[model samples]
Target: MPPSRTSAAAQSANFSTISVTFLGTASAQPSSTRNHSSLALCFGGRGDTWLFDCGEATQQRVQKSDVKMGKIRKIFITHTHGDHIFGIAPLLAGCLNGAGGMIDGMVDSRMEPADPKELTTLEIYGPLGTRAFIRSALRLTHTRLDGRYVVHELRFPRDPPGGDYTTLPPHRCELPGKNLLQTPMDDVQWGKGIWNDVYADDLVTVSAAPIEHSVACVGYVVNEQPVPQKMDPSHYLPHIKRNKAPIAYLSRLQRGENITLDDGTELLGVPKRAGRKLVILGDTYDPSPIMPLAVGADLLIHEATNAYLPGIDPATNNDDTEEVVQARTTSRGHSTPQMAGRFARLIGARQLVLNHFSARYRGDDDVNEEAKTVMDAIKGLAEKEFCGEVVCARDFMTLHVSR
Candidate 1:
């Protein structure tokens, strides 16, 4: 016999899923094999999607993938670096045109005009100068987004506030008749002062912290919110019906509130399901500031722009011995593979995904031999350092996050 409706609902509620797609994984510049840095996060239950770091041709990458451009509600820019943010304006323009059915002046004859209420406003969050950068880009391109793009500029605390870092008040662009953008600054306190809650909703909470890099850059952590457990109706429906429980009582029970039936019997609600945590880092030399956020994360997506020399043992080598390589990456404001792995190990991340490879490692002419060697070495180091699964990120790669 088919399962009852309540039983199915209960089973469905037992799991929560999130997926991350690597749209671009190259560093600084696009290579024959990879684009720049971009990724998409999709929530399975709500069908909500977010973009992180829209690099050059990110829209094209999205087009080639299964992601729907119209469904992207938020874009998070890690910094003002061109490779990290150059694609924002074009992507926005494309999204606007696509949603309004103005693609190449070819409109669907039977389609009605898009409802203003149905229009999706894209919220962009980034560091200081984000608004100016976006504004300048739009103005120079003569692209009028019709106030559909809302920008949120995050501010970091002046100096270290004793413990960690903190964010100053964020500047938000207001829309007509409604404020669609909300930040997690209010929800998260100035703990250790290193990280600030940037975005939070019923489904997830996102936090950001500055990392050590050439310019001002930030990394983000996404945490899924605990959902109320589903109660099997078959287990309680008969008792509830026999007791003639009111609709209000049933609603309260579903909400995990204790409810007393007319027969003076009490029903306990099911516990909530545990949520998952994901961390995505920008270009950084030192990831220590956000180490707390990375701790216990289910997935940690970090940049591995450089790799160790083939014969050098990272554990045995001293900083002085590797000064040249260190200077190269640090001067360019990037991280080495060993750095990424060490960070993941320190945090005890369950899974580590390394991306943003430097162009020097690209071996397009030789069928990616040099690149594969670098990636293999990085994976080897990471495997030795971290106890979890390690993966080298490639463009269009997707991973499912489930709990």
Candidate 2:
């Protein structure tokens, strides 16, 4: 059976800054230290959540973390690999159950004042095949959910191999006896791209763009929602406090408004420019074209699947006839920590976070240190390439991408 997938959503709140939480970081499979690749974006003081790449064990991961599935309103799946997907069905099922159950449990047993029935809805976006996959999974499980959500997927005529596109020499072709001299028709064909306007808020918007990978993949960008020009806060603060509703006052502050009370009290501290931006990349070796999409982002989360490991013979390459297929594994769309850092610097990312580590060096001993050594090396590759901070990720680690 094909694995399940869950996508990510974007949100904002008058109460807090927007943030994303990494739920899993392993790829293709789960390791003791990592699950698969998944992230949750929390927005809206309303607690709306967006999920990205729900791999297996995602439900458990969210359970262990502060992520509340009931808050997840959307999901974004990058690609359909077992380790990258597999968690969707169970999570959706669980979320649906939890939504109704939370209300039932609250009314019957707890003394909470708020009703749970008004919880947020959930939607999932992915490549073209997502709808079919989700339909099948839900059908097979004989389950129906009360909460409404949609899965968007990218479609391709043929399944592509894994990894990003590269300009391999004809001699390096995976095909036997094929040289670069061959006609363009002989070259591999890639899937077209897809762009979806997934989320919008009073002050920010989020969209997805198709990216090069073994198959059709996507990169996402979250930009601050467009807002009215800065208001003279000198005009708005005093009356807001007189309203006696801090939440209302804060909402007006975010919307860039100055309030006038009967006494003409003024508000201060409204944002001068737009909000911050963030870009999260999936597993692609050469994500060059998409760099501009990530430009000026406050934080960029890119995959660095290999870190500090000498070469390994994945033994999966068809080009083993060449004496050095071991070196070629890294060449085939897999990224090392150094490469992740190099790309981050190249894109002028404000912050570079390395994740999606290969299983080789994920051992208990010095995994974090080993990953850092490789990323730090990228600094030497491109002196002054990135002025941003570089971070090596750990499971359940959270970081705030501020404006």
Instruction: State each model's CA lDDT, in order.
Output: 0.71, 0.60
Question: Could you say which candidate leads in lDDT?
Answer: 1
Q: How would you encode candidate 2's per-residue C-alpha lDDT over 60-150 as one tens digit per residue?
A: 9999998886777677788777677788877887876523222211233222226644533465667655554655566555454544445
Candidate 1, poorest ten consecutive residues by summed lDDT: 1-10
Which ten contiguous residues of candidate 2 have the minimum total lDDT? 171-180
The lDDT, on a scale of 0 to 1, for candidate 1 is: 0.71
What tens-digit string does per-residue lDDT give for candidate 1 at 357-397?
87655523225665666667767866776778898888888
RMSD values, in order shown: 8.4, 12.4
- Candidate 1: misplaced stretches above 4 Å? 1-16, 98-118, 158-195, 230-238, 246-255, 311-324, 363-371
TM-score of 2: 0.67
Candidate 2's displacement at residue 72, Å, is 1.2
